[model samples]
Target: MPGIHPTTYLFAARALRDFGDGFVAILLPVYLLLLGFSPLQVGIIATASLFGSALLTIAVGFLGARRNLRWLLLASASLMTATGVAMSLADDYWLLLVIAFAGTINPSAGSVSVFVPLEHAALTREVSHAERTRMFARYSLVGALASAGGALSAALPDFTTGIGLERLTSIKLMFVIYALVGIAGGLLYARIPKRGASHETSRTPALGPSRAIVLRLAALFSLDAFAGGFVVQSLLALWLFERFDLSLAQAGVFFFWSGVLSAFSFPVAAWLSRHIGLINTMVFTHIPSSVALMLAAFAPTLPLALALLLVRAALSQMDVPTRSSYVMAVVTEAERAAAASFTSVPRSLAAAASPALAGALFAASYRSWPLVICSALKIVYDVLLLMQFRHLKPPEED
Candidate 1:
């Protein structure tokens, strides 16, 4: 912690943002249902939101490379603020769709906003290469823990009736809280010193020297993201609801534990990366998690399926911070933002297509095909990544 930069504030802000995302990810489909949107409609909105974020992030990655990261973060936070407020007020189907397309409402439990690349760029600059993975681990730990708290907060509706509040109103209030969190995060971004801006003096293309490596990673990451889209938290919760007759409060409890378990894996990932290297750590832990998910698809009872999901949760996210650190370690400081964005934009775009497909599958027979598909694709991605990048070690790994 002593060598850590002043960007600790950014980590806190990320936690806050992720916490908001946690509740919203669970609540969005439920809220849409309350408004008479079908499961298929929910998936459409999720895809639209992801697609819109990908476009916005693409612009930010390109233009932001030449500009100050602090301003980009502030601007993203401001948009986050407006997104919450807008969703809370809009009720028309088209209007809500438009908002979904443009807003920062992450239907998944992970971070993939324009803020991601900018924040990674800044955070990487603040740490030594040796400490980068650990720093990112702590950063992800804070996010996961806060998100657990937020997921638990979804139980608010179960209590809101005691005060005469409508269940839907209680859910809407969560978005209002999201807007407030954005305001607070903006203030944090404002604290970034002017000297902490980009290390670039020369104009750089979005990919620059790292173009080929980044593109390869991006293609693989997109396949992973596409697989991820099939079982995003919202759709997964919806699956539990339909398949097992789960209540909202019960879903909250499940997600809270899922977040906690995923969080526990971050430090473990950092430690493992120290021994086996980042790519190996990512691949070895990931295959088992995917296998757990595949097994979950065939689980006979609610408890059994839930247990498998918990197992998957414990291992699925071990790659997040390691992947981020690996990308940063390989790219030049000037290419950090571009690498982050190029890699993430494809992921967002790839993930954008699957939610609706998942919804359609659920709509048809409540089949467990999505989980099986996700598992298979993820395993393919893991194998390909390991095979391709096994020899490309970060400097710390040497």
Candidate 2:
């Protein structure tokens, strides 16, 4: 905490926004169910939100490096906050869809993929390579903890409704609350002392290698992400609702613990990377998690499903920080943004597809098929990543 003074505040604010997302990411599907949407329609809603947000991420990654990222973040947060308010006011399906499309600030805004690269580039401006990985690792730590907190916050609407708020209204209010808080965080970021964008990254780095690598990696990442997409916070909640008849509170508890498990896994991943390297760590640990996810599909009870999900969470994100770190490491500093954008765009697209596809599967009377498909495809990824990039390491700086 001693060295983390200003960074802590920023992390707190950033995490605030993430918390809103973490909470809503799980709550959205449930909100739609109350609106009387079928599973397929719910999936479309998610697809529109994510895929739309993804295209914006690409634009942000490229142009964002040239702009005031802080200002971009502030504006994006304001828009995201407004999106919540708008969604809350929307009364019907068509209106909600309009709100969804309008909520696409991530195109020119700070996002998870853009955020990691920008932050890495920022931290590098002042920090040394010896500490670079640690900074990224700490970021993972903050995000995991924040996500856990958000998942915990979702319980607020479920547990404390004595004030006579309708369940639908309470969930909407949670989104509103999180959005307003995100705006506050954005404001604080806007106030952070000045620093220019990372000039080291190229303005127009060659796209050939980065593109090829990203395409292959995206193919693999898409399979894994897409499989899980159907089970994001919202979809997972719906899955629990239908499969186990869990109330929202119970579903929240399930996600909360999953976040807990993820928080505990970040350090383990860093350490694991030392012993097995990034590729192995990503695959070995993940395959088991994917298999566990498949097992959850057949879980006889909510507790068992939660247990499997907990296992999955521990492995799900282990690859993320390392993967981000490794990808940047292997590419040119000037090309890092392109690398990030290339890979992330696909992930966003893949994530977009999962919800809709999973929803359709669920609607078609096979709710568990996505889970099974997810594990099988993930196993394929494990094999491919190791085969393709296991030996590739970044060049040492002079």
Candidate 3:
């Protein structure tokens, strides 16, 4: 413990955050469906939540620049935990929409999804430059495993007895549990900054550092995320239901494996990056992965289809860490947080469009179309990844 850095609290918070958010991601679609919501409506709710979370990242980045991260983190945790509690108690659709959009808490899924970069920037400020990529790789590893565990926990309902309780009730419980886990993570977060509250904090300058390139990446990220929106949970659940008659629990299992395969794939990808470069690692892995996703749409059996999904999961996320690392690597060290937000904001907004689109398609019995669109959009991103950044490399370790 003597040599260990003080900021490890972020990792613990990230792991717990992933566990809670993973559960919410699996169940929220089913929750909306039980309320008699259409696919489009379900998609809207999902998109709203996404935008809500995305908007907060800006606040976090801004606030984190001048404020103590511990205080900012604590506040984000409180807001998110409170929102999850609100989600569990709310019954009306409009109010749920309000909560979804207005919520500010940085639950694990949302936090690590966004905050890890903040963590990276923070740690980069605290540690030597030589270790940044290594730190990020470790951070991503923690999140992947935690989320995979949460995804697997989706099977819990399979063991619950009886079906008379409104499905809404069970879904609310999932939200409650997710919130509690987040609260627990927040509590644990108190321990993450091991150096204690006495540690001095400095403010970050808000001025833009590499304006043009960051915005370009953000634009491309938006395209990929917008396409991703179609396959949001309601649509994915609806996809399985219409196509394979899969129950929520069953689809949860599929998502569980999806996370599992994703969790396992990153390490291999890190290895592959050594040979092909991070940018190449992003495209080659993704092209085949996108094709597999398209094929899953036509799968004849649940097992075979699940196999395709698992394969897609394995290859698709290989780009995640590399993509993240590439963005950080490309910009000047001072601009890291802005670079993360520039790309991440558009990514969030683009994905925000999907749920509503998927829902509309479902109402028209054209839910399957979104998958095709999603695939095409993703293929474009993969191509862009290859052509745009293939020659880029990280600053070599000292």
Candidate 4:
């Protein structure tokens, strides 16, 4: 860690935020159930969070190039703080819905927030082009590990209830802790140099030369994200609960291991990208994982489904760090922030549209149709991505 760039601090803050999201992601659906909300309502709230993030991130993508990244990050963290506080204190359905829309309450295991592109830009600035992939791998590794810890933290209520605290009280306290983490994250972002905003200026084009490539990537990424939305970790946990009768603690354990499995793949992806190239690594690793997901849907027993899920975990996330690195490598420096935002915003929108559908699908059937649907769509995305981008290598690859 000694030679690590200052941008690693952003990764540290990301880990903190993700940890809070980890437990809360799983806890959300369960908490809603305890509050007498139907599955469809839970899906609506999740959709609201994604849709809100998409709009906010679109603004950041456009305006961020002309503004202080440090200030924007601080503001985003402040919103996280507000979100956590409001959700913990409010019980009215409409009020909770408003909070979900306005705040950064991720229902998924992944980190999708306005903070993402800003941090990507900052982290890219800190590293040489040669170091970008490795650095992103480490960034993803830290996030996955922290998220794993957070997943395990879903058991906090079990411990709290054992000590005589009310179940709802214990769950609410997790949100309070989320607020505290946001305060810490804001402080961390504050320490970032004022020069983080130095890239923003009057002369910068919003997207510069990479506009076309960014648009294409955004469209493709949206497809992948849309498939992802159908089986986001929150809804997946709910499925396991209803479909297999998994307890909260058991689901926590499952996700904790899944996160670890995914974490282990990041470095492997970085190494693999060095050999097979980013596009190849992305296309090849992704297909098998999607296949695993498809097979999981057909699994007749819980143990078989869990095994397939673990396999999918090991292969699924190899593309994440690689995809981020590839995008940064292809885009011009001036367009980095815009590219990150534009690409991610579509993903958010696509992902946002599906949870309600997934909820309805889950509500209407005992079959794991959502998983099947997720796999088929993801496979289609993989094939299309390979066909479209096979020749588009990053500069380092050339």
User: Compared with the true structure, what per-residue lDDT tens digits does model 3 show for residues 1-398?
Assistant: 35656557677777787777777776676677777876667777877877877787766655554555666667767776888899899878999888877774222233324454466565555644344545555666777778777766765665453666555676777788877876887785565453222223233354355677777778877887787777754467567877788876677677777777787787777777767777788789988988988887777788887888788888877877777777777776656665676677677766766767777877888756888888889999878866775665677521
Model 1 lDDT per residue over 12-131, tens place: 899999999999999999999999998999999999989999998888878656888888889999999999999988878899999989989999979778788988888888889999
Q: Name the weakest run of 10 consecutive residues (lDDT summed) in model 1.
A: 194-203
RMSD of 4: 1.6
386 Cα displacement, candidate 2 (Å)? 0.8
Taking all chains together, each candidate's TM-score versus the true structure is: 0.97, 0.89, 0.89, 0.97
Model 3 poorest ten-residue lDDT run: 194-203
* Total backbone collisions for each predicted model: 0, 5, 13, 0
- From the highest lDDT down, the ranking of the candidates is 1, 4, 3, 2
Please state the error at residue 398 of candidate 3 in Å.
11
Candidate 2, position 215, lDDT: 71
List runs of model 1 lying over 4 Å from the truth: 1-5, 196-202
- Candidate 2 per-residue lDDT, tens place, 49-91, comes to 7787667667766765466656666666677778888877776
